[model samples]
Each structure stands twice: as structure tokens, then as C-alpha cells.
Target: MSAIASSTSPQPSSSPGTTRNTNVTILLACLGVFASYLPVVGVAVALPVIQQALDASTAGLQWVTDAFILPTAALLLTCGMLGELYGRKKVYLAGLTLFCAGSLVCLTAPGIVLVCVGQALAGVGAAALLPSTLALISHVCPDRRKRARAIALWTASLGLGLTLGPVVNGVIVEHLSWRWIFLPSLVIGVMIVVVGMAFLKESRASRDPHLDVPGQLLAIVAITGLVYGVIEGGSAGWASPAVIAAFLVAGAAFVAFVVVELRSPCPMLDMRLFGSRAFSGAAFVMTVTLFAQVGLVFALSEYFGLVHHASTLDIGIRLLALNGFTVLLGPLVGRLMNRTGPGLLLVTGLVISGIGALCVCFFHASTDTGTAALVIAVLGVGIALAMAPITTIAMNSLPRRLAGTAGAANSALRQIGSALGPAVFGAVLTDRTLATLPAHLAESGLNPADQGQVGGVVAHVGIQAGAFLRLDTPTATERALSAYGASFTDALHMCALVSGIGMLVAAAVALVLIGVRNRSPHDATPEPATA
Candidate 1:
């Protein structure tokens, strides 16, 4: 971390009149935020319906999800700086309006292309809401415990949104149309904007610098290019010319982004934060943990829908095992943080998530529903344990004034992990499916064309179907099942290895960098400062 990268002074205290204003402002802020984030998880349940409705190709299916995340990843730092410069309240309100506008786009989109554009717009809204919400929270809840609780509540909203998104989408898509997903948010957004107009006070940042225009542009281009390349790489072979070109451009852009940030007078993101042992360590762990969680979600969605032939509603109910645990455990873990701090919770959470990954790895093609549910539930527990602690560590490490930017950056990191995890893991699974299929085809005595078809089927169905296959097979059906069983197990093994490696890396960093609790807000007296 650059030495100069240390936190600026804390914001001034709220006067009596300001206190009441802050509370109402925060309430509106929270509601707007919740409405925005609600879409993140909500779309998962609608994936199948959208796939069918749009006649989406296999590769196109991945893009549907990636489109929403890529823009959010690309523009996070830029939007944060916007809030820090103009005022968080203004930035936040603009984000809400954009989100609702994006929702409108999604609601009326006639094709996947338009829908994707809408998702990208929502990503912009995310970039805006994510950071500004944390900033406002810091301003509103000054007490450490109160702030921590509020942070926990805010974080929980993310998990809650993900969990409920599916349930709501499932019911809506099942009964009506997919457009309803975006429609509800528009209504809620209108209310938030109305309430916000009356109560929210504009908060100018306590410190500001000349906006680093060149650096901001480079960072956005680099991240956007990188994510686009990765997602495109997954669908197109990584070696494809277009994919390779994206990677090259992304690499060059990233290099430029780094150079610009290092020299910029007013860098959007403090590049020095990466040098801090604590920040870097926490950020890495948080990123990797999110990768596993989201990757698992992508994997399971395929497993349930394609293999188990589960309905969206059923998938929602089934995934409740995972999301349910997350919803239940988040608050309890937050309360625990008050006494134990976050390090232990992080380690424990990762361990559980690792274990959960293991459970998923061992799943048999014929694994009972009860058993599958248990495995998913365990993974959820791990996520619940890990998410809050990592967030708290990241937030508390910073000066209170930068809390919003830190929160937004943290949120962005998690999404980056979410984006990369599924892409990489999906690649691994795809490669393994291709590699293992030739042998399975030969073993089953199928000719080349039949073999290719089998490989394609296995890619989609093996995760669920292979789990139940018996190894000793005399019949043709038995033989095919055995092959699938082996392939699925191999894929699961790969997922386990990835999860284990990520967890071990996180655990090592946390053990070394995280020390005894040292800093507290009470350490200094409040003072008014200028932006």
C-alpha cells in the first residue's frame, strides 16, 4: 500500500437537525438499494424461461448472465469517484433513476440484445448504489456497534435479494411473463425517489482531488475488456482469434490503467490499498470465496434444470437449502462479530464452504434429493459465515469517510469473483467433458457421430445423472451410466480442487496479515472537514 494511501480524516458529526434528516435519508437509501440489488439473484430463476422464450443458444445463455455483471465490474471505480466528488446523495439518486430506467428497458425489451443492454444499465445503477449506500450509512450511523449492525443489515440485503430473487421470479415467470422481474423494481424505485427528495441531505466528501480522467477511462476499458474477453472465451474457444484479441486488448488496457493510476493526481481508486497486507489479504479471500459461491450457483442451475429436469419453482425451493442458510446465519454472524471480531468467523466460514464444495464434488448421479439439498445447504452455510466478516474487515480498516467507496469497491470485488469463478469453472468442466467423452464413446462402442452427441448430452446432464450410476455395468444402459458417473465425478473433483485451493490461499493470508484488533472509531475526536 502506498504510504500516502492511508485514510483521510473522518467526516464531521451530525448536528441534532441533521441527525433526523440522516435517518430518513438512510431509510430511503436502503429501500432504493434493496430494489436495485433485488435483480441480481432474481434473474437466476428466470434463466430457463428466458432461454426458452428467446431460443437462446448455449453460449448465448452464459452471456445473458454475464451481461449484467460485466458493466458493474467495469464501471465501479468510476462511479465511486463520481460520488466522492459531486456528493454521494446526488450520485445515489442518479443511480436509482438509472436503475429504474434500466428496469424499464428490461421490461420492454423485445429481444435478448435489448435485455442485455438493460442489464448493463442496471449494472450502472449498481455501481452507483453500492458505494453511495455505504457512504450514507457511515454518515447516518456513527456509533461503531450501530454502524456495524447497519452494515450487516445492508450486506444481508444482498443475500436476501439473491435468495428472494429466485422465489419471486419463479412465481412471476411461472404464472405470467418474465418482464415482471424488472417492472416491480420500477414501482419501488419511484417510491424511493419520492421519499428521498424530501429527506436526504447532500453530503460533500471531506477531501477531494482533481478528477483523474485518463486513469478512470483506462480502468473501465480494461476491466470491461477483461470481463468481455473471459465471458466470450468461455463460449468461443479461448484460442479463437476474437477471444485472444480481447485478452490482448484487456492486458494492454490494464497495463495502461495501472500506469495512469500510479501517476494520477486524483486516482479514482487508491492503488495503494492493494499494498496493505490487511486490505489485500481480505480482498483476496473475499474474492475467492465469492467465486466458489457463484460458480456453485451456475453449476447447480444447470444440474437441476437440465439433469434433474426440475422446474424453476422447484429449483428455487431446492436452492433454498443454500440461500435459506445464508439468510438465517447472516445476522447471527454479524452479532458474533461484536465480541469475536471477524478473523475467526472468516476462517470458520471458508472451512465450511470448502467442506460444502467437497460434498458437492462427491455427489453421485443418483444422489437422493434429500442428500443434494443437504450439500447445497452446507455450501450456503459456508457463504453466510464468510461474507459478513470479510466485509466488516474491509470496511472497518478504512477511515469512516471512505466507507462508501470501500464498500462499493468491496462489492465490486465480490462481483468480479462471481463473474470469474463460473467462467473458469465452466471452462474446466467443458474441457473435462470433451476429454472424457471420446473414451466413454469408445467404451460404449458408439460410432463417431453418436459419440459426439453423447458428449454433448453428457456436458449438460452428467452432473446430475452420473451421480447415481453403478460402476459395474453389464447392460448398455448401465455402461453409459457408468461413463457419465465417472465424468461427473471428475468434474466435481475439479470443482473441489478449485474451491480447496482458493480457501487454503485465503486462510493462509488471513492467518498472516490479520492481527489483533487495533483500530476503532473512538480513537479520535470528531472534527469538521472539507472535501
Candidate 2:
């Protein structure tokens, strides 16, 4: 119960060093950032392969992805605090070591359970990696201009990871094996460890840091419970005792988290940050944007693999239009923030993305790849416009001393949204497919008794609409495929509506709560903070 006030001490001064030292530091930090995010989207491209190889159910597939996201989101604030209390360099190297170990485990895992365990370990590592990387950049680059450029490069590395993950995984899964997805990450992790040990400096806050253990545990309980409930509710009846109990536990945990954070002498999350409209709005923008982006990628990757029956490489190529634009436009967006301001970019980007998401509502199984590519390209452009600007807004909204915490908070929220995107959208897709299945099956001219015979298969199809198209049974006739396609299209449309509406709502939030007034003269340049 220490009552130490948060301090705003200047960044620790580094020795006057050669330009080579700075470059190497930036390079190593960027590499760590890239490796941390590489697995986020890469796994989506390999989901079908994993599903078949591991005989994973739809829920299992979701868990495979979410297991990583869960710890990354849940432990981020705590990890960031730990980085401040201990040494950023120490926490970062430890994280890389754990990440490498997790990658090795995933590479050699014999079952889906072990794979999930491995992903969870990697997630814990990521929780330690992300904030520390950004904090290190801020610490080493004390000059405002150099710091800005360094942070921008770090942000670009994130986009690069998102962009390259799918395509690289596609190539590996198609040519080598799904297990190879983690191999490159393992190598990169080791390289970062060696380079970081030689070049990175130790940095910590001047204030005595308190680890909010109760708040951290509560966050894990809340997020895990809510996500589990959402994913399971799709299969178990929504009102089933298990789902209901999970939601209840999540609700109670969240309430407890708020209470603990509010009363703690030194909170993990300073709830007061939310009192600022601009800070809250920027966080919301990051959340909803990723909610649409991640969920769309997950759904479309499955559509490409299961519905279009495209190869993994083809799926990656198709997705290039969406992810590529984000990487390309990141720098330009940062430059534009000075002129047009983040508010305009935020609103414009969300609106454009919303339009792109809604456009998918018109897509059918026969939609050409070219048209799909064009639609996703628009989505990518919109995300690019918003992503960097949103980060700028969130970081600038706080005092310079809190930059590390701001980064951690924004990232944690974004990861929560990332976790929710798949769970919520996947639930909608499963439920809509299940609800639409019976009527479609009835219309296919099956007698009630014959339909009853296929009831078990229908349930499986509902769990994964793509599973229906993969079936070779007599029950999976031409009519059945058509019925399943219609059902899937309907479910996708519902998913689109949800994502589209979310973006639009985010746009409204930005318009009302966020403005250009907070934009610093240097376009929200980052200040020095403890790593």
C-alpha cells in the first residue's frame, strides 16, 4: 500500500555515442517489434491446415488464435509496469527468450493442446516485448525529431509484420509445413537476443513502481472469461449454464478490476486517463478499427481456403490488397497528420473502411478474385490512413511522462479488440449459419426424415460452413452445397454489417470527442519516457 506519486523525471542520459550505435539500437528494437507481431495474422492463413492436421473444431481454431491474443492483452499493462520497475533491457531480453522457447514448442508440438500452450507462452512474451520496445526507442532518442522518426519506424515494423505474416506463412505452409511458421520467428528471436544484449541500455522509472498483482489477475480473468463465453456460446446454447456462468464471472471480475484500480495507491491502469475525451476516443478508434480488420482477415482467409478452395499462396496474394496498403501508407499518414489533423484522418479512414466492409455484403461464392481484391484494397487504404494517426493521438493525449503507459494502454485495448473481433464475429458466423441451415436444407427437397438423417452433419456444417463444402458424403449433394453456400453468404453479410456499423460508430466517436486542438506543432511528436 505504498502511496508514491508518479514522477516525470527526464530520460536517463546515454553516453555520446557513434551514429552506428543509434542505428543498431533502432534496428534491434524494430526487429523485436516485428517478431512479436509476426504470429498474429500468420496463423489465420494456416488455420485450415491446422484444422485438418490437428482435427480441430471451429472453437479449437479460435482458441489457437486467441490463446496468443489473450495473454498479450491481459498481461500488457502488468508487463509494462514490470519493465519500468525492473530494467527494460532485462524484461525485453527475457521476453525474447520466452518467445523463442514458445516458437520451438509450437514447431515441435504433437497436438493442438500443446500448440495452444505454446501460443499462450508466446503471448506472455509479446506482452513484455511491445511496450518495452517503444519505450526503449523513446529513451535512446532524446532528440524530438529523431525520436519521432524512430517511433514511426517502430510503427512501420508493426505494419510490416502484419503485411508479411500472411504471405510468408502462405509460402511456408504450401511449400514446407505449417510448423515452419514459427521457425523464422525463432531465428529472429535469437538474433534479437544477441544484438540486444550487446547494444541495449537499462532504463527504469525514477519512482518506486508497484505491480498491481490483483488488478493483473482480474484483467486476465475478465478477458478470458468473456472471450471463452463468446466462443463457446456459439456452440453451447447462449443461455446454457456454462456460457451464462462465464459471462457472470467476467462481469464480476471486471467490476472488481475497476474497484481495485481505483483504490490502489499506484494503479496498473490509471482509470483517470479515460476522463479525457480525446484519449478515450483515440483508444476506441484503435479498438474498433482492429475489431473489423482482424475479424475480416480471419473470416476471409477461411473463405479463400474453404469456400474458394484456393491454395495458401493464392489466399495470401488475394489478401495483399488489404494488408499491403497499410504498410505502404503508414509514413504518409504520419506526415499528413500535421496538415489535416488526426480527427479528419480518423473519421475519413473509418468511413472508408466501413464502406469497404459493407461492400462485402454483396459478395457471393462466384465473386471474382479481382473484385474481392479491389474491395480489400480500399479497406487497406482506410486502415493505413487511421492506424498511425490513432497512435499519435493516443500518445499525445497523455503528458510526456506517461508515454510508456499510454503506449501500453492503447496497445492493450487494441489487443482486447483483436481478441474480441474473432470471438464476436466467429460467433455471429456460427450462429447465423446454424440458424439458416435448417430452412435451406428443408428447401432442398429433403423429406423430414432424410433431413433428420443429415442433422448431425448440418450441425458440423454450422460450426464451420467451409466444412460443408469439404464434405464428400451423399448427403452433401449439389443442392446441399448450394444451401450451405447461401447460408455462408448470409452469415458473412451479417458479419460485414456488424463490422461496418462498428467502424461507423467509431467514426462518430472521433468526430464528436477528438479534435485537432491537441495536435502538437510537430504533429504529436513523442517525448522521452522510461522504457
Candidate 3:
């Protein structure tokens, strides 16, 4: 490993001037994260509405979300490197500009294609923002304890964006068009850019090296191919030639990436970083916990809309229980992390969420708001506990100059996990629902003809057959609804089990390798005149 990678990150002196700059930088960084995340759950909740308005196919609808994820995942490392090479503030500003433009495109979009184009633009911007924001925090905060507190706030901001995305969009769609969902993200992004340009400090790697072209290309290919396979496997048959080809491409690209990184003089992502047990453990835990949380949110959102037939606003309100706790408990979690270490908290968070996931199996089509809120609250609190610690763990594992790369690697992995969440859970939902369809339909007392009708549509669109389920055939329709609801709940349980198992695995990883203390030394005098 390069000596720079082993050195502690720059520790800004604790003078009044630098302290003021750090606070502003942290606030701006949090806003940047918040802006990037607004479209995530916000757009998700609006999918059905988009479908109705745009008359989109299932594949097109999937692309609406996937378009945003692909560039964010594919370009994170490159963007991180760019921030490391150039100035982080410059890249961050550029990201905000792109995001603003993308938001504008989506806001005024005339059709589904334009919406996708807009989302892709925003994804690229997010690619720039995610790592730069982290790098900024890692570079600016002089004190480790303060860094922990700042990170806690940063994580809370992320959760707040996610928590409010649905509610904001829901309220928008209640009176306005679905297009208005893009507005909040746009407004916030632009405001951040304007303010940040004046106040945010600049930082970069102390050393410069040639870009690892081969490694970067392979990483893009691997991530894109893997996401494509999982996404297609759910929509297309898993054994289909395209899906299989995508997996093969992803696997091959990943192998090539490993080989290239090992041999490269200046690898885009350092191969040696993974040699540390702490780094590896934190990375793994980050992926699985994200997979569980994002997957749970995706599954439960479907449950509220498809099975419970809740309105968009109603569903968003109910989901507050799932993400709001992160905001409520984030600072406290940070303080606890300082006192108790990240290891105990990370494991406890995972276990609590895991148990809550199991509790999801108890939910049914007839579950009331109160009952659903309680169960979701438990999962939210658990995930909130686990979220901040891993980021700190990953940061502490790496030394100063590699802060941007570490942030990139961490963000990339988490984004990959988030992208996988819906695709994997949706696949499980569709497969399980179809596999158990016959039994439910038979019990519904529907005739052979009606069974074939409901089964065919569900086979084609899975649980998204909300409109088809609303067909008015009196007793037959009612029976079909009941059968579909039962099948959806069964699928929900399967999804919950998958996520719960993932959480347990993460908890185990946390206990073994990721310790509770900061590994990076912070003894150096910090840079002067940051702003």
C-alpha cells in the first residue's frame, strides 16, 4: 500500500477559524446528501402514478428506477477519484448542477423517455456527490469525536431525505401531477450549489497518479452487468439467454477487475484496502444491512399499495415508521458510538432489525395501521442504529489520502446493495406468488376460467396487477382479491426472511472483524484557512 494510504487523514487545527469552516462544511455536505436521496423513494412511490399517466410497460417502469441507479453505481469510483485528483468542491458543485438540470428535465418531461433521461442525468450527478460529500467530511473534521458526530448528522440527513421522499411526492401527487415530485430535489440541489460555492472548502489527495483505465472500465462493466442480470432475471425468465449472458458478463468483468487492480501501479480502488479485516468486515456489513433495509422498504411499500390498497399519501405516512427513527436517534447513536464503540451497536442494530423482519411475517393483508406501524418502527430503529457506525468504521480503517477512495468504495457497495434490493425482493415475490397461486385460487372457489384469468395477468406483471384485481365481477372478484392478498402476504414473508438472514450475516461479520475503536491517528496540525 502507498504510504499515503497508511497516513492519518489531515487533522485541521482546532482554532476558531477552522472550527467555523468545519461546521459550515458539514452542513453543506449533509444538504448534498439530502438532495441526492430525494428522488429515490419519492420516485418509487410515484411509479404507479407514472404508469397510469405515461401508460408505461412493466419493463419501462423498471427502467425508470434502474436508470438512476446504473450511473450512480457505475461512476462512483471515477467520481471519487476525480474529487481526489481535482478539488472536491469543484466536483461537488458540478454534481449539484447536473442534478438540478436533471430535475428540471424530469419536472417538465412530456413522456416516460424524457423522465428516464432526466433520471440518468441525476444519477451521474449523484455519482459525483456521494463520495465528495464523504471526502469533505473526512478531510475537514479535525477531531475524531467531532467527525463521528458529523457523520451521525450526515447519516441522519440521508435517512431524512429517504423518509420524506415518499411523503413529499405523495403530497405533490395528491393535488399536482407526478412531475412535481422532481421539483423538491431540484430546488434543494440548486440552493445547495449556490450556498456551497461561497462557503465549502476544497480538499484533495496529497499525491497524484495516473488513472487506472482498465480497472475503472472493468468495474463499470461488472457493476452494470450484475445489476442488469438481477433486474432482468426478475422480469425476464432467469434462464433466459439475456439474463444468463448478463451474469456471465458481470462475473467475467469482476474477475478481470480483480486481476487488473492487483497488477496496476495506481489502481482506481486499492486492492490492499481489503487486506485489513476491519475494512473488509465493514464493507461486507455495509452491503448486507443496506440490502436488508432497502429491500424491506421496497417490499413493504408494495404490501401497503397492492394488498392494503392504500393511497400514495397513506402509504408514505405509514412508512414513516421505517425511516423516521434514523433522524430521531442518529445523534444519540453517534454519542453512544463514542462511548461504547461501533462493534456492539452495529451488531445490536442488525439483530434488532433482523428480529423485526421476522415480525413482518406476522403481517397480513388485513393488518391495521397501528400494528403495521409498530412492526415497521422496530425495523427502522434497528437499521438506524446500524447505519452510522459502519460509515465511521470504514472511514477509520483507511488513512488520510485514501479518504476519497474509501468513500467511493463504501458508497459504491451500498448503492449496489440498494439496487439489488428491489430486484431480488421483487424476483422472490413474483416467483413465490406464482408458485403458490394455484392453491390460493383453488381455495378462493373461483371457477377454472377465472383462475386462469387472474393467474395469467399475475404471471405477466406479478403484484403490480392492481388494476386487474379491481375488476368488478361481484363474488368472483371479491374471492380473487382475497386469494391475491393471501399470496402477496406469503411473498412478503419470503422477502422478509431473505432480508432477515442477510442482517444476521451482517451482525456476524460485525462481531468478528469490525472493532469499536478509531484506527486512524489524528495528531497532525490541520490545514490553515480552509474557507
Segments in model 2 whose C-alpha atoms lie over 4 Å from true places:
1-23, 51-62, 141-149, 438-456, 460-476, 521-531
Stretches of candidate 1 exceeding 4 Å from the true structure: 1-29, 55-61, 439-453, 456-486, 516-531
Decreasing TM-score order of the candidates: 3, 2, 1
lDDT of 2 by residue, 432-460 (tens): 87788788779987667655545566575
Work out the TM-score per prediction. 0.87, 0.89, 0.94
TM accuracy, model 2: 0.89
Alpha-carbon local distance difference test for all models: 0.71, 0.76, 0.84
- Between prediction 2 and prediction 3, the one with superior TM-score is 3
> With candidate 1 superimposed using the best TM-score fit, by how many Å does residue 87's alpha carbon deviate from the native?
1.3
Q: Output candidate 2 Cα RMSD.
A: 3.8
TM-score of 1: 0.87
Measured by C-alpha RMSD in angstroms, how accurate is candidate 1?
A: 4.5
- Candidate 1's displacement at residue 235, Å, is 0.7
User: Over the stretch 301-370, how does candidate 1's per-residue lDDT look in tens digits?
Assistant: 6566644667888887888766666667767876877767677777777888778877777775566789
